[model samples]
Target: MTDEAELLQRLWNREKNSIDEAIQIYTPYLSTVLYYMAGNSLPKEDIEEIVADVFIVLWKNAGRIDSVRFTIFL
Candidate 1:
């Protein structure tokens, strides 16, 4: 499997760094999504909070998530 695939598997298994890797790889895209979703009305602090919430959701749901699937889902 590819590195990202391995990372995804690790994330599914609850490995600590897996979420970090995912965040590093996907934050820019996720930020853009959050920004757009908020209609650009959010301040920097609010945007940061929303991004944190996104990562928290990802961590909470990691077992059921496929990173590749989420790449598309995002």
Candidate 2:
């Protein structure tokens, strides 16, 4: 696993590769959470969309994120 602080720094720097790293590191967890939260109301594709949207939002707000206190999802 990549160091969280390094990932955060790379993200804040707007490094494209860091988005891929973050997706790889966080996708499974996010998918599972979305699955439970949706509770059968949403289709698989919708859950997937939500997960993707999360990364998009994160990337958009990367510069505003605080590495030292980073806790957006875990």
Candidate 3:
């Protein structure tokens, strides 16, 4: 498997470091996307809270999410 695919699996399994890995890899990207999704109308603090909420949900649901090939997280 690709390194990222393995990392994703680790996330699904709740490996201790997996969320940190995700933060390292995905936070910047997701934050940028969410900024655009919010039309840049929200304040930075609100955006940050939204981002945290999203990750929390991902953490909660990771194990139950169906993946075609470990290619989907949201």
Clash count per candidate: 0, 0, 0
The ten-residue window of minimal lDDT in model 3 covers 65-74
Please provide, for model 3 over 1-74, each residue's C-alpha lDDT reduced to its tens digit, 9 standing for 90 to 100.
66777876887888978877877788888889888998869988888888788778888888975555556543
Model 2 poorest ten-residue lDDT run? 65-74
lDDT of 1 at 47: 83
Screening candidate 3 with a backbone cut-off below 3 angstroms (N, C-alpha, C), the clashing residue pairs are none
Please provide, for model 2 over 1-72, each residue's C-alpha lDDT reduced to its tens digit, 9 standing for 90 to 100.
Answer: 338878999999999999999999999999999998889999999999999999999999999988766655
Model 1, C-alpha of 70: deviation from truth (Å): 6.4
Every model's TM-score: 0.73, 0.88, 0.79
**For model 1, what is the alpha-carbon lDDT of residue 61?**
89
The model with the greatest TM-score is 2
Residue pairs with backbone atoms closer than 3 Å in model 1 (clashes): none
Please report the TM-score between candidate 1 and the true structure: 0.73
Considering TM-score, where higher is better, how would the candidates rank from best to worst?
Answer: 2, 3, 1
Better of 1 and 2 by lDDT: 2
User: Each candidate: RMSD to true structure?
Assistant: 3.1, 2.7, 2.6
Show where candidate 3 strays beyond 4 Å: 72-74
Full-model lDDT for every candidate: 0.82, 0.91, 0.78
